[model samples]
Target: MVTVLIVDDHPSFRTSARRVLEDAGYQVIGEAHDGQSALAAARVLRPAVILLDVQLPDLDGFEVALQLTADEDAPAVVLTSSREGNEFGGLVAASRARGFLPKDEVSGPALAALLR
Candidate 1:
């Protein structure tokens, strides 16, 4: 199973996402509520993928993705948001993330496809 770190500001969403991914057989290794915490968690866990929220407390998800991908052994980043895909416009493409997913659509299978 792939390991993942879920980063989001909402406590309830994190709980829901963890349950969803876990049910689909992915191991949720850790979770962070903001970009700085996400970076710290990523360094320690070295998960295969990071389910990151677009809007964060400390830094935007794109900025976080950029920093994470700068590392030689960075994991795949799958950006997420409560807003629609078109809402972010070109910003998502500009990031180093593998893909973007609206929060409601996020799932283990969807994330797995992004990794592929």
Candidate 2:
């Protein structure tokens, strides 16, 4: 099964997203409320992909993506937001994320296809 680390500042969103992805066949390995915690958890769990929220309290998702992808063993990153993907503009492309997913549409197949 594909393993995942989900990063979102909203507790409710994290819980719901976990349920959604798990039901869709992804193993959710860990959850983080901020960029620092997400990065720390990723280092330990080494999930195959990270579903990261675009807006975060500590550090925004783009910055997190930049740091995450710099790792030699970097996990595939899929950024998310309630906003449309184009709203992030060039930052998404520059961040090296696999793609963006609207927060409401996140799922195992969506993430898997993006990673592919």
Candidate 3:
């Protein structure tokens, strides 16, 4: 099974995402509401994929992605955001994130596909 780490500030979003991914045959190993916790979870859990919110309290998704990517066994980071702008696009291009998705655009199958 693919282990997933969900990093989002909203409780509803995190619960919903966990249900969706779990239903789609993905194992949710950890969840974090802030970037700092996300990084800690990533280090401990070492999930296969990280569904991360770009606007985190402690650190931004790009910073977390950079730190994770520097690790020897970094997991793939999929940035999630509601923002739609050129600046976001540029950040994604420069970061270590594997992909970016709008918060509402994500579906269980799509997330599963990303893991695959």
Superposed Cα deviation of residue 106, candidate 3 (Å): 1.7
Better of 2 and 3 by lDDT: 2
Model 1 residue pairs with clashes = none
The root-mean-square deviation over C-alpha atoms between each candidate and the true structure, in angstroms, is 0.9, 0.9, 1.6
The alpha-carbon deviation from the true structure for residue 25 of candidate 1, after best TM-score superposition, in angstroms, is 0.7
Please list the residue runs of candidate 1 whose C-alpha ends up more than 4 Å from where it truly belongs after superposition: none
Error of 1 at 101 (Å): 0.7
In model 1, what lDDT does residue 89 have? 89
Candidate 1: what lDDT? 0.91
Tens-digit lDDT track for model 1 on 1-116? Answer: 88989999999999999999999999999999998999899999999989999899889788899998888788989899999978988999999889998999988788778889
Instruction: Estimate TM-scores for all models.
Output: 0.96, 0.95, 0.90
lDDT of 3 by residue, 1-116 (tens): 88899999999999988888898888899999998898889888999899988899888778888987887778988888877625575898788778777888777777756556
**In candidate 1, what residue range of length 10 has the lowest lDDT sum?**
106-115
lDDT of 2 by residue, 5-113 (tens): 9999999999999999999989999999999999899889999999999898988789989988897778999999999999978988888899999999887788778
Lowest summed lDDT across 10 adjacent residues in model 2 is found at 104-113
Compared with the true structure, model 2 gives a TM-score of 0.95
